[model samples]
Target chain A: MLSPKRTKYRKAHKGRIHGLSTSGTTLNFGQFGLNALQPERITARQIEAARRAITRHMKRQGRLWIRIFPDVPVSVKAAETRMGSGKGSPEFWVARVHPGRIIFEIDGVSDTIAHEAFALAAAKLPINVKVVARQGEGA
Target chain B: MANAIKLAATARDRAGKGVARETRRQGRIPCVIYGAGQAPVMISVDAAAVARDVHASNFVTKTYDIDVGGVSHHVLPRDVQFHPVSDRAIHIDFLRIDAASLINVSVPFEFKNAETSPGLKRGGALNIVHHEIEVRCRPDQIPAHITIDLAGLEINASVHLSGVSFPEGVVPHVSEKDFTIATIATPSALRGKEDGEGDGAASPAEAAKA
Candidate 1:
């Protein structure tokens, strides 16, 4: 659902996602968040689902900040067609979930509530994640 | 020391998420400058200029003369908010300062005379502990980067904050403790190799005895 209005070029280079990730290591916005342990392409639908889970758990009381945004365009080919011609049509937009990147952050709620809400949100994602709290919040 | 740069800006009065978003849409960076016994002044500057300045080495230390609608304001960048996906600078906060302002700023380190160090010549690695030292100084008196002379350092030798020269009128904020800046250490890989050789020599004699 979230795609860039314009791009320099249609397709991007296959970037190397391997090696240790360096960004998104620190908690920035919210009190609690989910840190990506493995690289993934998180879809907009998955993010929406995660958002719904958090909103449902919090009962619209606290703020939920989605750290990642679905901006990278992922193209797709027809399933039953031949594997020739040009690159496939733009299928969906995805947020590249590199390791150490915060996926979601929530604040203004109790620790127990934040934990359960993040747990529910984490289930919708595909990559390995660890729930992290704001430094000095608990320990 | 890095030269102080000038940035063009427009003064804004309103403050909110919608306002910030609108500023971004107009290709500008929304910012607020407060402190120094004055009320907060909201403004916006060219996003590209802020991005370029943010990438400079002295981004956190250098003084910026932001020209907002013909009025000039000397300030230091306090924070920069980037777009989540694009990693572009969207918003920023600049703290207003003056010649009389003795604000605390972190000045990063610049290792000097590394080639002259005997320990470094023998494959010793410099382990930096404090990347920067917070100092209370005027905006014009802020040092771009503090240099640590490693000429006299040997392996296992530590350089404390007192060893580096502080700029005139720039006093370190930490008067309580003499913190270490960096240390010359033996490389772990070399140490491991030397330890393996010592163990191998001892094992041969022990094996012969057995």
Candidate 2:
């Protein structure tokens, strides 16, 4: 659903998501966050679904930042076609989320409210999630 | 600061997704050099080179002499935006710098003499509080890394910023308070285990979690 308008002709090999992330490990602009505990390719559709769930819970109260963007082109062969032809054209887009990557963050709301919001969002994903608060300053 | 490294680029006429995609197609990263009271200039540099420079350990502290067309402009890399999924350098932002002006930068912390510390000799781990510190220094005075020696530190001892000697004319941005840089901390559970008692069981809470 979030395919880039133009892309390179050749396909790209799937790369490994290893080690802890450096930047997204901290909450830059949010109170509560959803940190990915496992490395997985989060589909664009899943990101959209999680964002919708978060905003729906917030109901326009707080700010939300989606740190990762779905830019990887995921190619899939047709369901019923016979195998062993050529690589399938780019099917959709996905974001490779690694451990410690903050998938979602929310601010401008109470701790319980943000916690509840991210919980609703996390239920839509396919990886283990940890809800963390911003470090230092105050609770 | 280390001498500014040379970077080669060309001025671009347009700035947009269309142009950026086209630039990436040619294996060059689209970038903008601004922030010196002059209008922003769009340019493109070798994507592979950008990737290499960005991965350098001291990328943030180093200055660069970016050659835009035939003219060279001294600049610092302010930001490098990578494609989220592919994790490749897609855009770079450079800020023009004057060699004489005082600028703020975060320099990585380098600790020394951990081997001689009494705490470390007793199986304590060095817990770093700040991996890097923000300091205001001239473009020429930025230290590659701030070094702190823990030669005489004991268990639970911490070295504050005031204890370390920064290069002359380099002042910390957090001068209002003496902040901690690192500490020699013993894992409390391991501390209990090393108490000479044969019993070294996990605490109740830790056991429950396990």
| TM-scores for all predictions | 0.56, 0.58
Each candidate's fnat: 0.00, 0.00
Q: Can you write out model 2's per-residue Cα lDDT over B1-210, one digit (the tens) per residue? A: 557888899999988999999999999999889987988899999987767666443567788898987988889877777543345677888888898888888776777787898987775656666767888988888878888998989988999887989889888897548888877766434555455432222222233454
Per-residue lDDT tens digits for candidate 1, residues B71-124, read: 888888877665533446777788887778678987767778988999877766
lDDT of model 2, residue B146: 82
What interface root-mean-square deviation (Å) does model 2 yield?
19.1
- TM-score, second chain, candidate 2: 0.83
Task: Fill in the DockQ of model 2.
Answer: 0.03
Clashing pairs in 1: none
Q: Give the TM-score of candidate 1.
A: 0.56
The sequence of per-residue lDDT tens digits that candidate 2 reaches over residues A1-139 is 3444556654667789887676776655565788888889998889877876776676545456778877788788889989989888877778888887888877645688788878888899999887877432110
DockQ of each: 0.02, 0.03
